[model samples]
Target: MIGWREGADRVGDLRGRLLDRVGTGTVDIDRIAGRTLAEGLDAPRAVPDRSHSTMDGYAFAAGDDYPLAVIEADVFPEDDPPELAAGEAVRIATGAPVPDSADAVLKREEAAVEDGRLTGPELDPGTYVYERGSNVAEGERLFEAGERLAPRDALLLGDLGVDEVTVRERLSVGLLATGTEIHEGRSRDLDSPMLANLVSAWGHEPTHEGSVPDDYERVESRIAALAAEHDVVVTTGGTSVGDKDYVVRALDALGEVLFHRVALRPGKPIAVADLPEHDAVAVAVPGKPVGAHAVTTLVARPLFTGESELSTVEATLSTDVGIGPAGFTYAVPVVLEDETATPLGHADSALQVYEETFDPSVLSSSTRATRADGFVLTESGLAAGDAVDVVPYPAVER
Candidate 1:
């Protein structure tokens, strides 16, 4: 893991990452709530004529009667439905629209319409009928750009009678994992789940997910094919100067490498390169588990999903952290108290085993972590009382 400064320097424009060939698409309004404006092709709908209810009640000026008030009835949303003259009441139901001639409504339970005359107990003003346009105002901006549309967003659009929307097409980032020693889980042979996982976060899905086995030709072919099929391409492993690192050669073959390495620990091998398409950027990360995880938050997140840059909040250290590496950065995990954070362990590329819990399936009832909150230890050494920042892991929610 890289220090806070090293991680911060690798982030890209938040909005630019969202600009990967988005276009109008059809989606029910319900899903828009959690989705960003870039994913939802949305447009404003013409205001719809809605009614408070269809109830017909005594419409009369409020406060005119305490125990009894002179009332008139008859109101509808339509033009010229009926008029309530002075000192008279109109019988309305639960859903009937209040007549323009009426100002307030006396509920049927509260008033009695007997023998063509209405009488009701006294009530407060503005008790019965709904005010006009109380639900929505005329000419209101429903949704703004860069906002994620949620279920309510879709419902609101439907309520507004909007059918079609103009939106950019969701982005598609190509996923490429470099290195020969890197291996996916047991079931995956050619599938790159790290790349595949980017789909949901990055606004697009992967068309291909195959790892390059440290061979320049095989890696180059996969990257080229994916780059052609998707907006952006990502590669894991083979990013450092190891003999098996093939990402450098593959990227050089495809397009120009913007930057080959970042001055950070754990993820120092990270490289951000340009693709053939506009706004298409590819990030190459190391093969280590922690390296890939850290790189995802730093380079992958912004390049693919346009998510907020890695955020840091203050906490106190739980243990003593001795950082002897000179001029190097480290991402450490800490146990957070009310505002104090406790260092969990030393965070290094090869030190992820500390966070892993025993696989109950493999060894049931093992004394390992069942759950943990991911925390980052700054490059600065820390002690039990030292201050730190706790960034919740992506898998865990605060």
Candidate 2:
């Protein structure tokens, strides 16, 4: 098995190769959030276009003495103001375009205007002025290829007069569950629904293709069909070395298995494959619910979102937590409160499943474990008060 970082890197490389297959299209700026840019974008025009006023005051060339002549007309955001002569000022509203000859704005509260004369404290150049191209310069590189757009990015694009953006098309994901108990209706197909929600939240379309038994031929056939229909096929369960674990075998027969497992506890059996024949990718995750969520977000997310970086928050551990193994990196779920993180399944916590050591096997199946606010990835044991970076659920879920 490879390390988790290496697994993420491999999946990111797969995304680059699959970029062309996914293609690109134009989307309205309002709908561009969560989409990856297909090409780098240069600012078509400078933001604000020209120098303006940042406050409702006077505008005039700096380095001039006070008691200047006041312009008769006021400048609002919608109207352009006339040029001002030296020792002259104009009443300007916020966002109003400042005249080319004017640079300083004296606040209305400080200015004394009487008999068309304006007087205020000494002013500096560019004071209270929004300089042209200060926000975004013309021809400046705004976004790079493969950069994912956030909702807040719309504000900048809108200011640049951009109504639409070219972004890579969203990947279509097919969720498949493999287990006799689930296929026969004796057990709930928990992974498919959760996987579907995750794929959608990652800005992709997910279709729950339903479950198939642990039959080798059946698993192979269903995977082949799903691969042909979707850009990605996400299979849950049947990833171990057991006789009933046919997902990995089927993937190997259908395509190239990039890696079979990762050095991650509770999620070690994750697998990624490239289905070249069908022009699709397959990610096989362990059946355990918590493990499935952890592996997919850490490893498979980059394939869909082109993002591998995890946003983390620093917190103090409230309890000592130990790992069972030395080589594996364990994802210990923790509840964050008042800048302190308490391991969810620790004996001191509500679950009370483990004493000092983290039991991933049991915790992976515990639905209560989902209540964790985030998780800490640690290779060694953690002591109380130790500073750790916690990857919040919202960081990966979105």
Candidate 3:
């Protein structure tokens, strides 16, 4: 088995290969949220375009003597600022472009205007002024290729007069659950709906292609059909080496299995493959619900989102949690409170499946473990009060 980091790296490599075949398109700024930029974007023009007032005050050339002549024309946001002569000031509202000669703006309340003359405190150059190119300079790189665009990015793009952007097309993913229990209605297919939600959250289109029994032929044929219909096929369950576990075997027969398993506890059975014949990729997740979620977010996520880094929050461990194995990296679920993380399956937690040592096997199947705020990935045991980096669900979910 390989390490989880290597698994993520392989998934990232798959992302690059998939991107080359997916293509790109132009999208309006309104519809660009959650999309990846296909090419770098540079500022066409400088922000503010020209020097403008940051306050509703008077614009005057600094270093001029007191009691300067006040210009009659007031500058509004839409009006062209009238030229100011030496020892002259003009009324300027907030966001109004300052005259070319003006270098400072004095607040209205601070200014003394009497007998068509203006007097204010001593001013320095560029005070109370939004300087030209201060926000964004022309030819400055605004966004780089492969950066995912968020809704907040629209504010900057719209201010820069960018109405649309070029972004890579969203991946079309098909979710297939494999299990005799699920196919026979004896067990509910929990992983498919969750995987579909995850795929959608990762900015991809996910279709629940339904489930197939443990039969190798059925699993192989269904996977092939799904691969033909989607850019990616995500199969849940039947990833282990058991006789009934046929997802991995079917993938091996249909394509090239990149990696069979990772050294991740509860989620080690996850597998990734390249289905070149169908021009698609396959990700086989373990049957365990928690393990399925953990591995997909840590490994398969990069294939769709093009991101490998985990955003984490530092917290104090509330209790000592021991790992059964030293070689595998364990993802221990925890509930966060006041910067303290309490392992979810601990004796003190809501789910008491273990005393001190974490029971990943049982915790992976516990539905209550889903209430965890985040998880701590560690290879060794964690002592109480130790500082741990918790990867929050929100950080990976969307």
lDDT, candidates in the order shown = 0.55, 0.92, 0.92
Single out the weakest 10-residue window by summed lDDT for candidate 2: 80-89
The candidates, ranked best first by lDDT, are 3, 2, 1
Ranking by TM-score: 2, 3, 1
Per-model tally of clashing residue pairs: 47, 0, 0
- Clashing residue pairs, backbone N/CA/C < 3 A, model 3: none
Candidate 3, residues 11-108, lDDT tens digits: the string is: 99998788777879999999977899999999999997999999999999898999999978999999999988899999999999999999999999
TM-score on alpha carbons, each prediction = 0.65, 0.96, 0.95
Best by TM-score: 2
* Deviation in Å, model 1, residue 350 alpha carbon: 17
- In TM-score terms, candidate 3 sits at 0.95
Stretches of candidate 3 off by over 4 Å are 63-67
Instruction: Provide the lDDT at 191 for model 2.
Output: 89
Prediction 1 TM-score vs. true: 0.65
List RMSD in Å for every model shown: 7.1, 1.5, 1.7
